[model samples]
Target chain A: MTAVRPFRPRSGFHADQRAGRLFAAYLVSLLLHGLLLFALAGGWPGHAARSDKPPVYYVDLVHKPVLDPQAGRPEPRTPDTPVPAPPEKAPVRAAVPAGPAAAGSTDRRVAAALEKLRDERALQEKFAAMRQAQAVPKETPVGLSDARGTEAGVGTLAYVQAAIQQNWALSPYLLADPRKAAGVEAWVRVTYSRNGRLERFSFEMESKDAQFNESIKRALVKSQQLPQPLPERLEEVRVVFNLKAMKDLAGLR
Target chain B: MELITNAGLVVKLVLLILAYFSVTSWAIIIYKTLVIQRATRDSARFLDFFWARRRFDVIAQGLDDFRHSPLAVLFRDVHQELLQNRRAADGGGEGLDADLGEQDRVARVLRRATTSETHRLEKYLAFLATTGSAAPFIGLFGTVWGIMDAFHGIGKSGSASLAVVAPGISEALVATAIGLVAAIPAVIAYNHFVNKVNVLIGEMDNFCQEMLNVVQRLPRSRQER
Candidate 1:
């Protein structure tokens, strides 16, 4: 009788041989697929290379303002007046005078001499009154309180006063009613660049009309420099344009 | 005619194609991730139920319930072979003493079953690997085509300014981005599924050997009865 052999399970079959084959197949397929993808997409490296360069951009320059070195001093001509050219032949015209013109001119000269004497008297009286006022020391006037000994402070104050006087003055031709503009008061805020060019201009308060705003904008644009060079640390120029004082002077209702 | 006849059109078409691939790849990635997750959970639950019963007859009877499971399919094949061998021995008047022949038959059945299940688990996984490995290259092709067209357009348009070059290049680049979107998830899923299937196959192989050991140890009366 043959003895039954003890059941010996083969470990070879138990080993993951199939798994290895599957893994190998998987890897091979992965490689082939990778190759196919590369062929289709042009590969990862090429895509990365393209991403490295950024697109270029172009922009246009606009709104540049020219600056003149000297500006902001009082202009000689008022809006109401026109500048007259010098007479080319004054001497010849003066010598050839008509008989009625000569007689009238003599009479006008006599009257002008009398008027000049009266003006001198009035000027003498005004000088005397100023001396008396100086002799009696009193409280400093409110208007003079802001007066500064520094050259820059004085210059800036003078510029502000002059600008206010020139633009805010009442004339029948300047406004619908000369008295109406007197009530308009505004603060001008000015910004300048390092090279003394006006960079920005604005009003702290609204102007009486769009025309006033436009005029201020034009004034700053036209003035290449402030009335005086700003102090080294200060680049912004600010001043109040007071129309209320003009209204008072004109006696507006 | 010159305005319309530029490389820009080609670049746009390539970009559109890449965009389609990229959007689809991302969708596949999300879908496959969910599928693999659910498969893993189901497989684990089935394995737990199979082992907890501790009786081969109960597991064999219930295998049909687990027919959708890859592991269950492997087990069913082995069980069928055991039943067939038992029936054959009964016909031969061996009275169930044909233990050696039965063992041989069972091993053969298991080996064949293992191969089939492995094949089933690995199905569709190849597509993932292909996408992962190839998507970037596909995108690059589109970009290259676009760049070539851009140069051609430049040759005809007589200008190399930014306006002429940027739009074309931008459109071309969309393809490469799409390729990457498709490839990354596929590569990840391929790796993940491979690992999971390998582990299940190992478990199945181990279980087959255990069943063989149990069958070999049965008493003669029990085997015949």
Candidate 2:
């Protein structure tokens, strides 16, 4: 009998053969992929492909807007003075005809309406109070606390006072004694032309201290001119200089 | 190509992975084609030879010509088991119980051979399956990442115009295109190869039964000798 060979599976040999085929196919596949990539790189869509790069738009940022938000529109104007609110009218009583059945509906409606009117009146009063609170009173400049005259005269006197105060100064050494200078007051009748020039000044009530009087006169002289033209009116005005008031204006205790 | 080159880092990585899948699957596709074609052709020829010869020893000598045939390899293995049984009987081990034992042993050999042949036919198919199922999602991940990056760029630039938004989106979509390119062929090839493998397995089943019938006739022939 012919000798039968030992049984051995050819799995290893078959595996090696399959591996070789796989590698060969890999090489072929790699070539095909390379060719495909080359075609894509060459711009595969013919002339339709966007070969030229997209346009690079440069932008600049600015704090102010470039485009006018209100272009082609009219410029809005604000009124120099606020418009006043319309005056409130008195509430008219709604008439009710006679009878209890009609009176009940009317009475209930009147009560509701009266309640609504009260709420509205209260709101209006509250709003008026708020407006009054918001409204600031006109204040005369400080150091003119006792100056009295017409509106134009007071305005002119205030201007004169301001000019004098700008130049007003007295050294402590000029006072003979601090306690003696305490009650000193000087009254001067100052004259000014309508063109805003201080014409002359004479003391109506002179202080006991001569240096104090001289200082007040010197302040008037150094003023040179009123800061602004006064309105044409009675030309002369009185200015009183009280030591306490002067001290207070100077912020001294 | 410009689109691929200009893609974001994550997108580039996704495209690279998809390219690898595409290339490797193509290689597998080619290799499986060659292997299954040869296997089917050789199995047909081997079966024809087996039926014409009707001689196990002669068939054994000719197994080399049909090495790619899973059926041929199965026959060779069972022929070896039959030879072992014959040698045992010639050495004075033959009895009624021993004959039954030989049949059991032969049956075991038949089962083992069928399993090995089935495994051989189904090899390298899982890679194709994985590529088909996973490649698209991986590409989608890349696309989402790229679009997120684009929106992040828009946030930094403070621009939502089409000029600013279009290029990044275009570059992002390249990943999905590559993914679809990779997955489509793989899925189609996977389905086709699965069908082919099933057909081959069916043939192996039929071949296994035929082999069992031939192996069962062996002991009677030996007893007559």
Candidate 3:
């Protein structure tokens, strides 16, 4: 039988043949890409971003926000004073109508309000007494303890300001083509844990735009925990997010 | 526009690669289209000429004309195998036995030749495949990087307005657009060329079968070394 060797085909010369053309294609590719980039960049030249009336006061700060909770009111506002409660065992209590007076609706309403005021006063006094009882015996006076923890720690004021300023981002909502509110204000009470992380913070601040308020809140959250360790026995802390500081940083004079 | 121009270095480099791929893919498209068209036509004409002849010797004289054709290469390989075996056996009783057994061995040689031709037809097709599959993800990575930079810019500027955000995002999108542009044609061309190559290879396989039949029909007395 004939010994048939396996047929082996020679390699095609086309790839080698097209070497110059392929290189040329590469050049053309680069040129085309450059043109695309140029077109994307230069297309619609003079495309101006029309802006709206600038915001009024860039930002405002209500040191405590009376509701946001208000501006540095050292004393909590008191409701109108309630009439003094009658003695607990006084015989006069039996003579008084229970609430629904048989004579008139106005009389009944007044009696009911007076009774309610008495109950609230007694409750407040009981709470005060309970608080006094719970207080540990210490060298510092009770009145001075609350007054001692100021709204902000004197030592960390600059550090806190810098950290908040660095973390806070101004969104388009605050600075858009046509701006919305002239300015926004917020009050934040940040209480820190021993580990320097936020323990609890009262952050619900009111603004014309909810989104604007949220952005500021987010900035506070994004601080990755504050830079300094909290002072032992210090708790009360408050910060005012004023747009004025941010605008200054942005050089928007 | 400024966003893209001022995009991070990595982003710019990604865009550059996408551009290169786009250019090379299109180049391949143009080149392959012309080459395949010529190859198909040559194959058809060569097939006609091959079948027109009754004798193998007469068919070989015109091989140069179809040298570029894949089918022509197949024929040359089988022909060479035939010549080798024929020369190995001198004209005697051994030549007779060799001729009887030659056809089957010749068929095997034809199969191998056809495979080689198919390999030639499919050259450079893998590049098209890789570009088609990977470019979109590459562009996506670039876009993701760009968005990260945009957010970083926002953090730096302390402005979250779209006025500040729009440019960076738009610049990032350019990468994705270019990547798609580069990949689309490559995918299409790859599918088309693969189909065409398959068709051409099928024709070669059929030609092998037909050649075997033709050789089988020829008289053993005429099968000389």
Better of 1 and 3 by DockQ: 3
Model 1, range A1-253, lDDT digits (tens) per residue? 2333224322211222235544554555455555666655646677768867999974311111222112211123334333333223322124344598597887677677668767766776676555544443353211223332322123333443343344444343444455455556567776655444566666778677666555555555556564444333224567665555544566654
Runs with alpha carbons beyond 4 Å of true place in candidate 2: A1-17, A43-253, B92-100, B222-225
DockQ of predictions, in order shown: 0.04, 0.17, 0.15
Please give each candidate's TM-score.
0.45, 0.53, 0.50
CAPRI class assigned to model 2: incorrect
Q: CA shift at A2, candidate 1, in angstroms?
A: 29
**Chain B TM-score against the true chain B, each candidate:** 0.78, 0.92, 0.90
lDDT of 2 by residue, A1-253 (tens): 4334345533311532556778999999999999898777774666345666578974421111111121111212225323336446557675758697788888888889878878877887787655643343333222223433222123445556666776777766444244755678988888877776778878899999877888898898887575556564325578887776667666654
Q: How well is each residue in A71-159 modelled by candidate 3, as lDDT tens digits? A: 12243222443333444542234344445555587676568877987887788778665554444344322232223343422334434
Give residue B217's lDDT in candidate 1 (0 to 100): 80
Select the stronger candidate by lDDT from 2 and 3.
2
Instruction: Name the candidate that leads on DockQ.
Output: 2
Model 2: residue A192 alpha-carbon error in angstroms? 76
Model 1 in CAPRI terms: which quality? incorrect
Runs of candidate 1 with Cα error greater than 4 angstroms are A1-253, B1-35, B93-100, B219-225
Best by lDDT: 2
Error of 1 at B26 (Å): 5.7
